[model samples]
Target: MIRVTAALSRARAGLMLALQAGLAAGLAWFVAHDLFGRPMPFFAPIAAVIALGSSVGQRLRRTTELVIGVAAGIGLGDGIILLIGAGPVQIGVIVLLAVLLATAAGGGAALIVQSASSAVLVATLTSTTGQPWTRFLDAIVGGGIALVVMTVLLPLNPLTVVRRAADPALRAFTGGLHDAARGLADADAGEVRAAVERLRAAEGTFAAFSAAIDAARENVAFAPARWRARGALAQYVDGAAQLTYALRNVRVLLRRAETALNDREPIPGVLPVSVRHLGDAVELLRQEWDRGVEPLAARERALRAVAESGRAYREGVGYSGGVVVAQTRTAVADLLRATGVEYAEATRRVRQAIGWTARPHKARRRSGRPGSMPS
Candidate 1:
């Protein structure tokens, strides 16, 4: 059932992309063939499809690369074939030269691949290697049509894209925290190890969120209709790094928790409770983000987690347990920052909640980096 629902959602998203690609290809063919009267303008539709296939983000840059690569490869192949004549050796030399030149120009994967592919097509397919600027012009028309279709005609909703990408990441983060809590409460090292593995597997989800943010930014920038999403997107922009850090810190916390359980360290009940509270805060933050509301509840819950972690610390823990407390403090600060709090303010709030008030004569121990683990 879950797999079916996910498939349906993906199909819905892909439908828009398919429609955009079809419209761009058709328009490019019409412009290149009917208007420009170019004979058999197959390169036009091919360029359009290739540009769109690059990625959902960076449409303009990808289109530009596609057109330039096609033009350069075609020009190079034609000039070389005119000089050396078309044969296996000539085709190999032209493709090699095109690839080297594209690489030297610092072109991306699409540009480099398209350059070699275009050179091969020109060397093998064309009988007479005269000036083939018509193919280059066809490429330009195709790329321009792709840009228009992606940005102006069929831009995705920025908010929808962001939320859809964020859902899996946030769920994984929250679920990992809950699993860690359960492991700590049960004093089960194996369960906490399982949680660590789950968190590690979420790297792909994190990458997806990063890509979605870039795509959403592009949508809001080029599509005037998506301008209203700019305000909502600001939170995601601010929180992205902090959320990544929080996820990392929680993984570290769970690892230390597993160590503590394995070593028979004193695991306080409040420790697991605090972890559960952190998980609750994460879920609340996602809910608030989807509803476009202020995440006051999440902040409150994170602060409470900090207070509980402090209580657990004072309950007299062993070395690994103490490490867990320190990590919890750092994770709480990161969660606060993820809720749009400023750095200094979030640090101060976390310190206050964890009973770390400064004293004139007493020196406090410095906290280590958030996600670093002891060897």
Candidate 2:
């Protein structure tokens, strides 16, 4: 069933790509005929293919850069053309000026390629005629056609991508957090490790979502609200990272508990509440991430629960049991406290950094040392 679903998804994606390609080709043809006053030769097809294959977001950015670069190149080229005279020397000066201008604009390899292509276009179409502006306008028209086609036909909307990606990523994060919390509660080392790994993978998915948003921003036709949502989603990624780290520490503590149990002694009364609170926190984070909104009271309640669990664990280990068990409990309690503190700080930092309202509660402050109960 899963394999069939996967196959269907791939097929749909392929269909979308085909549609986008066809749209780009049709638009490129129209623009070629309208601007050049005749059917375009091979270059129109080539340009359409390039535009279709290129990332819509990246192509838009490159177009803007190219426009700026071309304008600068023309200004310099014209100056050089005037200084030298209309001859082999003039053409040579134009090429030199194009390269220099492109380099100054921080055009790497792609810019160099664009510069060479633009230089050729100027030389063949507009050189010695004393009008670089006309050729510049032509390049803009070509680029504008490409941008418009991309925006209007089968658009690769970043909001849609981010929204689609956020659902699964949030599920993974929440599910992983739940699993880790259960593992911590039950003192199950393997489950905790697996959950943490899944959470780490979810972080990568969020990164991809962020990249997609960046691409979408370059499309002039895209909605401003979509851009704002993307920015909001980017802020949420930092929160997710902090949650992942806290969960990872919980896994480590679970491992320590496992080791102590194997030694025929385990920490007394340490697992249950810790896991429950952690799970609650994970769920809250997942909700916020998916919806791009958070309830401060709910988040604060979850944090308090986790902190309480850490406190309980610390209290349970205060007495010396067997040397091995006592030391193990102490270590686990320290880990839990550290993880809880880190999680709290991460949530607070995310709120402050993003200008979100801070929860109206007393700030949590951990004792300077590990053995003390978390406050």
Candidate 3:
């Protein structure tokens, strides 16, 4: 069922890409040929299609690279074909020259491939038209229109893109947090191990989240249409990274929990409540991420959860139990950072939320090191 859903999602995304590429190409061709009276102007649509690309993110950089590649191809192809005339040898030479020149010019894979392709067209077709600058003009027309269309015609919502990737990841993380809480409550060794495995499984979700944010960053980087949301989108990207860190901490906490459960150590009652509250907090965080609005009520709830757990800590249990609470505190603190809180403040807030009445936590609380967590 999951596979089917994933397949359908991919298909939908593919359709969107195809539609956008078709629109951009057709528009480029029309403007270059019909509007400008350029002879056929085939390169224009080709440039537009290449610039549009198929990926969901970073159209700006891709468009820029494509434009550079097309320009290089047209210039190299026109000059070489004009000097040497069209032939198999001239074709090969122009392509080689275009690729080498593009490479030396610091072009990436897309630029290199585009350069070679454009060189071939210029070498073979430009001579037929008897106008060297026509295709160069065609290339310019295609690239500019592609950028304009990509930027404004069907502009992507950065927040929507972030949510499409972040929601699943956040849910997975929330589930992991819930499982870890349940394991602590029941002191079930098997359940703790299972939760750990589930957390590991969530890595893919976070990876997709990271990729989506990167795309959003590119989309918002320069386009005036997307610039207004740039700050919010950037926050989402940073928040995703912080969530990754929180998940990592959750994994560590769960492993410690599993060991504690296996060893017949005490499990605090408040720990489960705290963990469950944090689970809810993650959901709220999702909401906050989606809206790009943060009063950080989610972080507040998470901090409160830590405070509740600290209540259990005040009474004292075993060393393992203390470590568990400490880990939970730190994990919640990590999550709070995702809410746009500073690390120092987040740590202070987590400690305050836990309502730890005791003195400062010593280095020997869990692992015997100075402020560094055990890996």
Candidate 4:
């Protein structure tokens, strides 16, 4: 029964993909044959399907490439097939030529596949049906219509798209910090190790968020309709980058924490509590990003958290404890830098607020690098 249910669920997951691909293919075909009067232009719908099937983050760039790939494939195949005549050898040559052309043009997997497939169609099929450059024309038609359908016909709010993508990564990062703090508070080496593992896994989220930022940038650049969002999107990208930097440092902190736990170091509970405060700052960062709310209070809260943790450290922690505390200070500095503060100024702000006095032996500003993301 469980197996049957799982299979059904998996199948259901494909429903949207099927719907999107089918509709795109149908519309592409209609535009190519009905509107453009391209006779039996089979490559048109294929281009549209490929465009719509690409991942959400960079659909604009991918669609443009797909259109170019289709044209490149058709032109190469048609020219080669006409010159050499249709045969298995001609088919191989056409494919090689298409691949070389697409690769030389800096096309990715989608373009390469489209080029190869389009070449195959031209070489194997009868020349009477797909005249010289007819498939290329069809590709133009399909690709243009696909862009129209994507951008104008069924437009999504650009900010909404970026926010949706960013939320998952942000949540993963915040949750990891929370769990790490909990483990630290409990002095559980095992729990710290687990938190570290989760933080490591969130690297994929980091990459995804980075991609989403680039996608949002591209979306805003190309779509005049989303021009008003440009400033907000820039701020969001900076914040997301800072968040990624903080998470990376958090991973290192968690590892050290695990080691400290194993060595039976007396990690002050105040330290973990401060980590929880940073987590709150992360939540507030999300609110600021999504709703354009003020983050000044959240920033103050985070600084206070770090300062309190610092005061506890000044009372005299051991070597490992001091290292962790320094890391926290750096992390705090990173968060501040993400708010568009200059590097030195951010350092000054964090140090002044946290009352971090430089020791003769230790290097200053080792908490974390400038967080250029969070604003």
Model 4 per-residue lDDT tens digits across residues 198-291: 8898889778778878777777776777778888787677777777777877777678777878888778778788878887777767777777
Query: Between prediction 1 and prediction 4, which has the larger lDDT?
Result: 1
Ranking by TM-score: 1, 4, 3, 2
Which residue pairs clash in candidate 3? 307-353, 307-354
Number of the top lDDT candidate? 1
lDDT per residue (tens digit) for residues 1-375 in model 3: 999999998887667567777888889989988899876888899888777773456546666888878877997888787777789999999888888998898878888998899888777665644676678788888888877776777667777777888889989888988987887888788987898899899999899889888777777764567888877776687777788888987787778778877888777788778888888899888887677688377988888777776776556456666666767777787788888889888876765664433444563365452222421
State in Å the error of residue 55, model 4.
5.0
Superposed by TM-score, candidate 3 places the C-alpha of residue 343 at a distance from the truth, in angstroms, of 4.0
Best by TM-score: 1
What are the runs in model 4 whose C-alpha is more than 4 Å off? 1-31, 83-90, 121-130, 148-155, 340-345, 356-375
Task: Provide the lowest-lDDT 10-residue window in model 3.
Answer: 366-375
lDDT of 3: 0.77
Clashing pairs in 4: 238-373, 239-373, 239-374, 242-373, 330-367, 330-368, 338-374
- Which regions of candidate 3 fall more than 4 Å away from where they truly are? 1-23, 73-102, 116-129, 133-136, 152-154, 182-194, 197-204, 207-211, 214-221, 226-238, 261-266, 269-273, 291-297, 311-321, 357-375
Off by over 4 Å in 1: 1-7, 58-63, 124-131, 355-375
